[model samples]
Target: MTYKGIAISHTILFLIVAAFSVEPWYFLMLSVAQILFVPLVLKLVLKDDHLIYYFVIPAVIAVSILQITEDSRIDSLLALIYLLFTFIVAMVGFKRFINRGFTNIEEFAIDMGMMYLFIGGLWFVASVLEIDTGFTPILTWLTGIHFHYSSFLLPVFIGFLGRVYKPASYPWLTAIILISPLVVAIGITFSTLLEFISVLLYMIGIYGFIVLAIKVTYKNGYQKSLIVTSFGALGVTILFSLLYATGNAFGIFGVTIDFMLKFHGFFNCLIFAFVGIVGWSIWTPPARYKKLQFPISKITGKGTVGEKILDDYHINKTYMGLVDDMSIFVDKESLPPMISNFYEQTMHYRLFSTVHWHAWFKPFAALYRLFSSRLQQLNLPFTSREMEMTGDIVAIEDGRTNTRAWIRKIETSTIFIALYSIHTRDEKTFMNISLPLPWSSMVGILALQEQDGKLLLTSKSALASDAGIYLAFRGTIFKLPLEEQFLLEEENKILTAKHEMRIFSIPFLTINYRILLK
Candidate 1:
């Protein structure tokens, strides 16, 4: 049978079981999810045919058995099978996410939705086996449903909506929506107050999604209406959620779990999930992710060794500035004259740097310095001794992404061979720097700012700035948990600068620079 045919037959069988089952009609909620909603969503987000999805058939059968079975061991084993299917789906999502890298918010949302299904599957298993999950079995089952819809389906829907039209507030709103599921779970497990707060956050994100849905121009009026109705259903159900959360937090008995299951769950599944699935199926928007094709540093594994064996590209060995013109990237009018001049006429300046390794990371730094010195990469002395930096600037003839190689050396030992380039996205320009490593590169996207006559560049920027440190390997880039700040100011006709590096928000190294016209 075709995938669609099987899904329809499985859903029908589950509905029949629910119709005749003695009690626990809520199992019907999970039945539709296992057989229909999840498959449709996987079809949408997954770009290619995956063998893992075939497991969904057995998973459907397992969920069907759970709906009518009274045997404890059988239910547990069946739930385990379903959980394994979800685990496979999650792995597929994780692999997809890694291949694409951290580029688009819409795609990220979709990928995250795929990964979240495993959590839903885990909770489903726990609910069936009667695990001591700190909550009653009913709550546990409800939690599983919560993840399937809110964590999984909602994100996928929002992602598809984003492919159609993304508003300015979409990223922030999506971020809140993405993180709220975990926050809600944390709140439920620990604090009522937290649960209430998370519900409020979720409500804001869902309402924001509704506003965006109205703004998105659909293929036809019917599709738009369906999409709007789907979001609208969530708008109402989220209110129910808020009410329930408020009651639970404050000891109010107005809204109960039973009321939520009957009303909230019904509207969400019928209107939100079913209608939304049909609506998107009418014309699912094309994926927003395009694999980044910008050339990475070909020199890998101790760049000094690889430098001798260059790629099939022209490299003009010359003494040049970091940038031909600072005005091309930022407003030259706002920048300090010395700062602007330094970049435009970089070779005319002499560089000196004092490296400071933070106390907490000195030991690691010392160990790395031993290996790094041999590779002539990021090799800074442990002591805070000022060293003169001398290097040659070479222009790389890459028309797509105009780049330069700035090889800096401290007394004959190569410290950095940073390939500098510029990337413009959404009308904002970023400074892209790549340092070659073993079959990979450390990439830093820096956002520029002029503040109080000083030039401020940071990997961590405010919203709208695609600025972050990342690691690129085999055509895929992923964010690294690191931050770097570079502050430059002109003092007494000389440009002084401080470069601070941190990992997980803890300072590890700093380089103070003094630049003078030679």
Candidate 2:
């Protein structure tokens, strides 16, 4: 669904839920809202991407309905169904890890994200079913909230930053971050000593991400603001997390569940989850954005090794609009001899996205879709962004998105492409072939391929052998062999295309579109 669809529907649900909510229901309501907003923020706008909205919108609406009915039996049944859904998503998360191969910083972050989601799901199930694992009712629900909000963002905020910023240089700190959430979960259920250790690790992870945020910067004000607000909120979120966790393990005074709820709930929904998710949705790759605090005299553009290699075709055009009628334009003068065969091929585009090629890649694929939401819509260096919270989309024309001249060649089942994006302005980016290896050390591939009777095309980047030294030098860490698929496909009939990138074989950065040509 479009951004407006998500916004209007959720607003109605929030209002309906609010009307029927009773005292403690307020906490659940807020938590649910935060959960709903989490992906929206991740989507950089209130977008109802299929994976999330299909489950969340229905679940929330059903929740409102059940709450309105206020029947005990129905509530119990809904709780069970909710548990089942949680189990499904958990399974999906597992499949994602296996596909991503767990070797990049983003994958590590994704691993933790899945862990948090699964564990948080369990907590939610327990709270709803009223299954006592030995805590007060308020505490039990609060724990669920903790898992939902804090645990959810543990990976998301870090992962979001990791997507753009170079990896952290501190290995020990990176290890602590990768495992701290698990340790914290285990600490809560198992031992006080472990819990205490987890608390320290937790503080390290939160502060660590904040430091990373400060170290990295963005050209887009939207992304920069999210970096500040999400981390700033997380700084406070962690304090409360530690406070609440310690209270659970060792009766700390003045840190009761009620005390934390009033304070933490607002921040969780508004500042941390809401604000941070909004930022995640507006994410622009760090390489694409300029950096701050760099060595001034010798500073260079943030082009990845891959980007610098493919710079010739990387034209930045100004009029990237769809061809409403047949307007065949090709610069045979600029064409590589290898791809001259398909110069006259012009057809409409039909765009769609699925889980990445492998099952394990789905989770990451979903993330890539969220991160590169705008680029998918217009397959150039995506420069459009949504302002925070107001649902006002701010469009900046940086490239001509319409393909003027298109050509393709396949060798040994590998595809190569070159196309011109026409513009009134002479700016052009010849990027849809193989990436030019930008000034930054990022790796990406731009090509067209056919697999299983289908053609998939676009620029893609997944961290593997290429990013090892760069990630280490930047102080970021993660498992390797990760994939990011920012795709556009055109096999038959209507063509499919996107300005998207997936990390860990998941949707890391994307925007999507369809074209109807005459």
On the 0 to 100 scale, the lDDT of residue 112 in model 1 is 91
- Enumerate residue pairs that collide in model 1: none
Model 2 lDDT tens row, 1-518: 76646656666666666676653555554345433654354343112336745666545555555555644766677755555554555565565554443444554564566556656666666776778878767657667666666665656566657666656453345567767766776776778767877887878867877788877777577777776877888688678767766766678734766666667777766787767756665643421211111111111123222112224433454222223222222343443321222223232222223211335554655565453333221122222331111000111222334432222211121111222332221232212211111122222222333334333433333221222111112322222433433333334434444544445345444545442233
Estimated TM-score for each candidate: 0.77, 0.52
Residues 128-227, model 1: lDDT tens digits: 7889998999999998998899989999999998898886798889989999999999999999999999999998999999999999999899999998
Q: Which TM-score value belongs to model 2?
A: 0.52
Runs in model 2 deviating more than 4 A are 23-26, 29-31, 38-52, 66-69, 170-175, 240-253, 284-518
lDDT of each: 0.82, 0.47
Best candidate (score: TM-score): 1
Candidate with best lDDT: 1
Off by over 4 Å in 1: 1-7, 20-23, 47-50, 302-347, 352-415, 420-432, 444-470, 479-514
